[model samples]
Target chain A: MIHIRRDVCGYCGACVSVCPRGALELIDAYLTVDETLCKSKCKICSTVCPLGAIELEEQ
Target chain B: MKEAYDVLVVGGGPGGALAAKAAAEQGLSVLLVEKRPAIGAPVRCAEGIGKEALAEFIEPDPKWIAADLDKAVLIGPDGTKFTIGNNHSGGKVGYVLDRKVFDRELVWQAAEAGAEIQVHARASAPIMIDGKVSGAVIHQHGKTYEVRAKVVIAADGVESKFAKWAGINTTVPLTELETCAQYIVNDIDIDERANLFYISYTDAPWGYIWVFPKGHRCANVGIGIAGTKSGEGHRAKDYLDRFVAREFPNGKITELIVGGVSVCKPLECTVADNLIIVGDAARLSDPITGGGIYNAMYTGKLAGEVAAAALKKGDTSKMALMVYDTTWREGPLGHALARNYAVKESFIKMDDAKFNSIIHSMSDLSLDEITVKSLVIAIFKANPWLALELPRLLMTL
Candidate 1:
């Protein structure tokens, strides 16, 4: 259940820095979910995005 | 080591060094500490000081000044602009300094007045005895030692955490914060006579972009955006990077610095038993402009004197330290800061069109005539809609 939209986002990469699951990387200044390292164990990454730009993997 | 002193100043930056200088000048025993191995290594500031601030606090030494400026250019959100000159003093409309040498000059003044200083001595926690500040626990060369003192003045900069240990509320709300990222670049074209303040409502939000020229050749180009508007840490920096790429497609990126600015009111209380807070620690930073080097030095001097007086009376109570607050509020630095907060809150509401109109109205003013408030007034005059929005803006700030 990821929930990020690229158009309105500022590309600050706060999610990339705070991601515990190593699920994100900066792509053109916005976050790009790296499926290889992502674990849906917790949704902390989605919750901390200030712009509400984070998307989650489905449960 | 149970070494005792009359006053202990922490952090070797501008405020700390000046506080130590002021205390030493007043004939007090003082010990100043810097965590770094050298006095002014790893520079972090844009190095712009107004003339009004410098003259009132410390005299300029030729050894540290890089250039003397007499003009400023305020570029509005929509690219409309104006310049001002000959209207301020102390780090005023002039002087891009060599901050490393400048910082050393201040500390040197304290040493000239006989204050003991220790470099490479990193102060950790404040030493409290029965609710009284005794001194501090310091770390250096991989070992911890204790130094006891009658009073301590906290002149640590914006990212300070020392006040929390002493029980002072030092948190600054995000809306009043500015996230800045700057690159000191060479081969950039600029007026040697004018300091640039570039702004935009959508881009910087509550803050503005600054391109301060170091000389005729290089400049410190940076952007400051309201931290809360991004609603996320680091977004402001990313915006700065984008802004840079879009504007200076060919300029080489040299040095980069990322930091935050506090444009909020100073804390209600900056003093505690045997403890006095000065400069960035107390949020004396101008809410609108995000400048605090002057306030830091001014408060540093006062804190030094107040600490000495408190010890003279054998009373190290927080009440004695309150004198510093009273001293500052009655003076130019505090009064100017108070007036600035009101003006800063108003400008934060302006959009790009509003900004352009304001700048368009004042395209002919000299450096002496340009001011943050005057520009807001122009915006209100051109668009009565802006005039009606003042009340809401006041409340938000």
Candidate 2:
């Protein structure tokens, strides 16, 4: 449902740290997601994101 | 004859209520006007607040609270990380308040102190005499009337147009204003004890994203950007969306509020003759956090006290009204506000790598140093750019 660009992510890790679903992580200097772990319960990280790099698709 | 009030507070927000409370307790007659039909309806905040700053004015009540928070996230422009750790600036540690109830409680408290309140009344301008501020003009239900008072307190909020009428300069430079927007969402699972602030350099450049959880299932998610940083093209809503689409592809925006936060220094003077400005009207908001509830109440209390004193002395002039502005700036909130503005400036300049390093690193530091300055300093240690920005902020602090 959510997409993060590895190239432009800049690896700030803010999204990784703040995700309530425990969905995001930092791997190789970019943001990664634990797709299996995410409940799609809520996505607070994308809303409060700083760089505007996030994109979402409907389930 | 119904006599004029001793203290007339324009606005029934936290500032107005507190102003009325402080004045009435001091034995001054007070009147509070609210433009809305209700005291605390249509809540607009992410609903988060530090607890200690709140104690400066009133005691904590669970009747107005939803949750406690103990963490912050600092992301960079490009998704880099910075972690500020956990800190308590306001008392009792944290909260995600039920603002509608919370605000009404404040008004009730003021009323208990003998302050009168009127809803749906919009204050227009100050009632002046011989070049000195006295009271204000109000319009309600298609009827206009002039209310006279010894002291008038303007708690009209940020972007308020009252100061011009009172003959005071209240312009907030574009650079000093932060355009903010938010969404209340359902089904967000978060630690009830920890709140989240997500920052990224390329993500928000001048603003950060916030997800203040109401409980294990609900959250108020939002982002805010410094005005003039990205120019007309920069929109808080757009940033919020882009971030959400990436992080919360499934979450939908349930409620939205577009507003602004001011990071500029407090107005040079908040008092003009018999008139005193509190809250956003006087720019008492937190620059780094963009939080104003606690600070607004703090300033409102001070404003009310000063208004009461002026009435008692029959000297509602500039000399008698200086009390409100001087007191708060010297208190704990004011001390933090100054440090926060400096942090706000440094924060806007960071990129993702620095933010990432700092935020990820925060997981290792003690949660106590999460003050705005401490977080910036930690990130500065990791990034030379931040280190370079520190000097200017440090000098000001």
Candidate 3:
């Protein structure tokens, strides 16, 4: 699973752009993750987040 | 809102606003939707744009002009400084903008041109009919509307969900994506007439730090790094914090903004059946500078013109829309993108020593015209070793 620290997130949508699965979306200023589509192994979003808001957690 | 329209534009940034305005002016019923509560708030841009490029779209307004820069200063990794006057650079480096007000002015113009505008409207999914984007499912104010349209312009920006939903591969590779963080800092002494850019491989790998003046004693201080270089303690914000602590210790942070820029090439094709993608959604930002304002507005206006013409001809297919892609690619904007991408690739691979050498070499040059080609030529004359190191960059020029 991907853990999003909303408090730290700037809602810049950098993670959403690099998500190959198209699993991340920035609705206004809130970031949402589609669990079913999100692949934990692909940590592209985690790496690209300028604020380090998204993290991959062990299921 | 009507159940159908001639054109539907997603997003409310400069791109979507211009698209709506252009299409609506052509007598097309256009609907422009923004997910945000207002047109432009919580701004995400560095807000610097060239004076002439901007004049092509709208006249200059004092309300939105933060500062009229007369020169640009480049600081190398080893602190070698090189200054380029605005006239020497062909007046390319110009105003720093107040995007919050600038974007609203654009949206206002669109509305005045008869484009129906709606805020708090989010497009959750593309209404695909047999794989063709007919419209979108817009969620607004706790309700969803299945809006239909003859043409859909996806100006949804770097997040760009609409294009991906409509089946365009809009993913920016980690190495190619520039992660940026910025702060609106006040009470700092600065040369307001000059935009300062600091290039340091150790500090901001594959990107640069900038201080664009907003007004006296205030500026947009920011840094960007390649997405692949960002991590837990080495994120764009981390580097930015370090720079701010050193440069502007007494500066007050009034606002903080972070975002991603696709420094890769534009989309392979910007159109599909009944669809057109413009602006950051199409990844048209400058590869070297990470600037997208002019590119977004340029493509937005072009897309609107193309969409309107196609609708009048009663053909909204991909074949008809390819003109939008072809026209931009063949024009000056496209040529600059290609050349700059090559320059960016070469520059990012260079070490601190190479950067210092290049800046040192150019510090004494007095070129009347300061284009990229002239700069490269000057560097070759001063440091012939660089040609051997980056022959590919020279080949592109």
Clashing pairs in 3: none
- In terms of DockQ, the best-performing candidate is 3
Which one wins by DockQ: 2 or 3? Answer: 3
TM-score of chain B of each: 0.91, 0.90, 0.97
DockQ of each: 0.06, 0.02, 0.91
lDDT of 1 at B311: 80
The regions of model 3 sitting more than 4 angstroms off are: B86-92, B367-374
**Which stretches of candidate 1 lie above 4 Å from their native place?**
A1-59, B86-92, B231-234, B364-367, B370-387, B391-397
Write the residue-wise lDDT of candidate 1 on B183-294 in tens digits: 8877766776578888787667777888787776677778776655664544555667777777666677777665556788887888899888899778898876787788
* Per-model TM-score versus the true fold: 0.82, 0.80, 0.97
**TM-score (chain A) of candidate 2?**
0.76
Candidate 1 lDDT = 0.72
For residues A1-59, write the lDDT of model 1, one tens digit per residue. Answer: 46568764444443443344545544322356766777756655544343445665466
- RMSD vs true structure, all candidates: 7.5, 12.9, 1.6
lDDT tens readout by residue for model 2, B158-254: 6455665677766666556666667777765555666677776566667678888776667788877765544323557777778778877777567
Native RMSD of candidate 1 (Å): 7.5
Q: What is the lDDT, from 0 to 100, of the residue A37 in candidate 1?
A: 70
| Deviation in Å, model 1, residue B316 alpha carbon | 1.9
Candidates 1 and 3 compared by lDDT, better number: 3
